[model samples]
Target: MKISHLQTRFILAGILLVMTTVVSGIWSAWTFAHLSEVAGRTIQKSQLTTDLSAVLSDALEREDDALLLAMSGDRGQAQKKLDAERLRFAQAFNRLKENLDQPDQTQALAQLAKHAALYRAAGDVLLTTVAPQDAFRWYYQNVNPALRRAVAACAEIRESNFRAMQRAGIRARDDARGATILVIAISAAALLISTLVAVMLARSVLTPIRELDRSVEALRLGDFERRVEVTSRDELGHLAEGFNRMAEALAEFRRSNLGEVIAAKETLEATIAALPDAVVVIDPDGHIVAQNPLAKAILVATKAQGAKIVDDLPFSAGSLRAVREALEGKPTDETRAELTRAFAVRLDGQPRKFMLTAVSIPEFQPGRCGAVAVLYDVTDFARLDELRTELVAVASHELKTPLTTLRMNLMLLGESAGNLTPRQQEILATAAQGCHELASTIDELLDLTRIESGQLRLSRELVDVYPIIDRAIISLRQRFEDAGVAVQVAAGHRPAFVLGDSVRLGMVFTNLLSNALKYSPRGGCVSISVRSDHNGRGPGVLQIEVSDQGSGIAEAFRERVFEKFFRVEQHLQNGNATTWGAGIGLYLCRQILEAHGGTILCHAGDNGVGTSFVLELPSPGTVEQ
Candidate 1:
């Protein structure tokens, strides 16, 4: 019960989500608790401090009235006021103590109590003073001051507690907010993981079903060329494997049982008739086992018998000796020998190329061994191969002279045109540009040869494509500006990086840009766009498309455009006649893209208007498959 990759992703995402949610919830709860405690403390301190101050103020006012009444010699009034004042002070003391949130404030409260008692005694002494002024002075210097100090002490306690509570509240709130953010981040991460997991599971289940459907469709179309890929040893993998085996077995059974097995004589006759060549088989007894229709025509045209052996035929002595050696198993490889010696046999009085191949037939009884010989006409392929080789060689030599002369002229123009007139300089510059293009064309030819010979080596690495595009444009910017072509490079996003040989990638872009610039008319736009999209399986990919408002490919020759040495024009004219180099730029581009596990294709560019070369490259993976 091995899970698919999609299933694994889904499970992983779910686990991440759950863990994040739980952790965030726990953190948030803890923060909230701390915040609540701090808020409670703050409220307690504020109320207690505020009420204590009001009570103290009232007590001070009553004491002042008592002093004034005694000074006026109103003894009964003074005594009554004194009594009220003492009672008020006592109430304030009790309330202050009650308001303190901590036991440490108890000592401060006790001190306030002692101070209040002392202040009351001092006030009584002043009220009954023999010298009234002395009593007033005593009240002012002792009782009133003592009362003020006691109130100040209580206020200080309240202030300290208030500050402590405020700080605590702030810290608690901050903690709570921080916890909430953590919870949110974790929850988001979890949600993302969950989504990823669901997607993975769906993909896992759907991928195989899709592949099965595709295979079935292929089978329906009479294509039995595909096999299901086993990505895992899971039940699905096993099922796919079994289904593939069944398809293979059925295909083989159908091939084997669809028709009866023909007799040896009939099989030989069928093989000869189906083959586009004359065929003859002879046993050791020198009797002809079989002769195809072509072989019978040959025998009749030469006035020979079809049932006779080759020794009786009008073939040369060398061919007869080779046949005799094949019969005796004396030839090399103990099988067969064939010679290209000419014979007098004719078909409609026409001479045609023939390739003779002979092999011994071991199924014959002892002392009756035989060999089968087949002839083929290979004149067309052999001639084309030879002519192509000659063309490559001749073109290489012919292009070299012009290339050298062009380089020399560029060098001379650059050196001598230092103080030339504007028109003169312009001509020289144009000539130099033409020379460079010719050199580039030659380089393309050489590159194609290297590619075909499997000599192209790629050194791959992670590369930033922007710099390559920038560099290519910089190298060709002057050329484009001079040609009056508008060259544009489209900004690319995704995979942010690509894996390739920078030099090779640069060459690819440079070639495309150059082609676009060369072919595009003045004021026409040549755009280079890079794109990347995920293939929905592994890492995403990056692609570059270079398009130009130039002549598009002909309908009939679209597929043949990438072939080496294939030019669009049948006869190269003056401007295009210098196609001295082998036409291999597009071919090389295709090879390079393919080597990077990418693809390059030409499409009908801009509504059958211009040519567009699209290149799709894989963001090379680390794991080698």
Candidate 2:
């Protein structure tokens, strides 16, 4: 158990209390035990001292009786009595010496022993030497005085013992007083220590608890930022740390979520403000959330007596059907135009087109959605496209008759140049070819205008790809011969048929063939193969690859080549520059393929040799409705 954990604090506190109690208990036991030991020993020693004092006094009294008998003049009887009394006194004296511990008591007992011996000698002289008549007088003069001195010595010995006993009593009282003082002192110290321990424990515990209560109250009042200050590296400290961490996590969560949402909201508002288009934002429930000024104006003008954004903004019946699709992340091309025309609201009694573009707001919460619909003003662009197509149509049609006349005159001139020089003949031939190319270019321009104006409809039929490919090869044979390029048609399906317009697919084939020959180096080989998404045997889909063994197109510009009027590293020649073919061929090729529900891709040739163009189309049974 470490202080890092609260258990340590509790355990430590308990240990302190237990130690205090144990120490107090040990002190109490020692105090009582010592006092009991001292009391018992003192009682026993005092009793022994009193018994020895009594023995000395009794022996002295008995010796005085024997000396009285000696003064009566019975020599034999007195001698025997004296010997008995002397023996008894000597025994008591020796016992007193053994029992007495004080030095003064021992000295008094020694003096008493000497006086008893002198008294015994005086009694003997009275009995043996003095006559009975004068014995009484001699005894009274010598033995009686000696007896008195011996009794005085005995009294001194007894007094010393009494004094020793008195001292023992004083010592015993002092010992008791000391014991009581020791016990009281130990108890007071224990009480003081216990109080201190309790105060310290209460302080350590209650201080954190008070702080914790205050912090918790703040937290309850929604102050997630509130934190407890850690005072010690204990349980409360760790708890405070945990609380702080929780608060920090919550704070960070709020910052990330609320801040991003507010920022995104502001950014959206700013974006809408900046966009020229009229914008409307709506929720998944088809209710309007926000709208720009232009959007508001459009709604105000378009509202039918009383209306809302969901069902009454513009064109009826399929109103906002495209909006639902847009919310589903539909491709913009499919719905944007429809929505644009559908969103028409009369401004000054004339309807204006608005391209409706719905952008989804990110789902902040899962399974809920909102979208921003912006209506772009594409009315001018739409009119310009129409005008440009009409102009191209009129110009192409107007140039066709003259181009034909020019072609005929060149042919006639070629017939009339039989006698001309080789150079002149070559020039004549080039002139005729150039005229033919010009006529074809004008025709293609007319067709391009029709395609743009949605009038060049494909005649759906099971057209044989073999015929289209064969005709394209035959039409470009002269160019292949002129460019000295070899044409290789790989083995393909015999009756390869695709559901497309024969004339338009033929044009696509011819254009590819022409490009192959035009870009091919002298003596370079051109390869054409017809396959499918699967091999040619499977009823999968169709692919026609036209490849040229010449300078390959750079990878970056391959996709851009199909964009209208886009030329790779070249501009449309005005007058001074040499001519490259018109950039419209690949563009028209892609448009025609897409109109037939197919696509085209350009890639490096087999073995990275040259450029390859692959045209993919649905085989007969594989076309989707």
Candidate 3:
């Protein structure tokens, strides 16, 4: 069976413990058996020695009694008793000799036999020839000495057996002690081996675990190169194998994804580089984060020498404000509009027009916002617009002379109506009216062309804006009345004077008032208000607002209303039923106001019923308060 590391350790320890116990038990049993046998032999030899000593003492005592009987004159009975005693003594000596295995015991037994034979011969002489008195003397000399020698020999044999038993007991005890020591040593060795095995097994299991732990930590830190080394065929080895596999998989994943990520990054960089317009990305701190080639080129051209990319870009102050406001998550519509206007920059020793646009990038990082600024080169477009305007101006100027001659001829024809038919006169009148309308259209076109071409020079002077507004209102008063609209002028108590041409300023107000009257419903009120205030750029500015009650301009068309030739679609659909102009009136107003260092904006009226045209003009060096 395939045992796990833990199971193997347990099995080995158990086997060692069982083997140690069984061997110790067997050894103890064998030692005790050998000791018992030695003890038994010693006890039997001691008993045999004791029996031989008793037989020798009895034989000596009976021989002495027979000698006394011979001294008493019973010769036959004494001899018979002596012979029986001698036979018993010989039998005891022979039994001791058969049992005697040691050399000392055998010599003692032979000496005892020699002493008994001499004592028997001496006892027989005493019983056959000597009187009773002589018997006593002989027994005291020869027989008594022989009996003493035999008794001494028997005692020596018993002492030898006893000493042998003592030696045997001592040897048995030493053997038992040696056996105990051997068992103890074997048990100790077994325990030591088992402990070492256990420790080795534990280390075998834990070493891999520690290695795996370190590998896991490395993986967490994104280091996928380290792998666990496999060194066994147990569960720990399998775990190491799995861990190494996991590391390989992670390494592969990182390589594969890294390649794709690098590819994607290159593609993005190439795409940005291929863009036509200059693109710059800035962080919230106004530092440049990234830029395309065009952006770098533009910056190098416009920015200061030796400036770093981390520095703020060279956009106009207004554009910088818009970018900051966007980063702060605030509205930047006005600033954005200002940025979209054409601005001049020197590039390669030539002045070029560029339009800047900034937009906030979405919250890509928490609490950190960024913005993208685009610089569009519109120099060619502006030059084209200027050229087209010049061409139109030239065309308009060429048509004006013929148009004036036609108007004069029509007037002459009208005066001669008496000589003409009624149909001819009617045809002459229509021709005169058509020529007037055409002349007015030509005049508007010429004025727009002059404004776009930068040829509309202003004669600057300090003039009160109220009088200019009043003159414009009076000139358009009859038209407003015909359209069933009312005109109201409200000026501040103090006069608001600005540096501008009075005629041009009046034209601005006239166009605004005329549009208000045209778009107003019957009996709707058109109010003109002029006030003096700061216009955000500096102190001492004039603010004028013209509001009318009419169908309001849609929010979508508000910005486009100032665009050239762009009329609201709904107004165009109304056609001839409603009063309409060629749409350059508002465009001209914008150009005129902008040229005078002023601004014009259209908004919904207070009640959201009509359009409000707001004009801001910079005050002259001095303000009349």
- Superior by lDDT: candidate 2 or candidate 3: 3
- Candidate number that wins on TM-score, 1 or 2: 2
Backbone-clash count (model 3): 0
**What clash pairs does model 1 have?**
6-200, 10-197, 17-190
TM-score-based ranking, best first?
A: 3, 2, 1
Residue 276 of model 2 has an lDDT of: 80
TM-score of each candidate structure, all chains considered together: 0.37, 0.51, 0.52
lDDT leader: 3
Put down candidate 2 lDDT per residue, 531-566, tens digits, no spaces: 755454655678889999866777767877886666
Query: In candidate 3, what are the lDDT values of residues 317-407, reduced to their tens digit?
Result: 7777777776776655532252225767777788887777777876835887778777777888878777777788999999999999999
- Cand. 2 TM to true fold: 0.51
Mark the regions of model 1 whose C-alpha exceeds 4 Å error after superposition.
1-409, 412-416, 494-496, 534-538, 571-582, 620-625
Error of 2 at 218 (Å): 12
Candidate 1 local accuracy as lDDT? 0.70
Each model's lDDT: 0.70, 0.75, 0.79
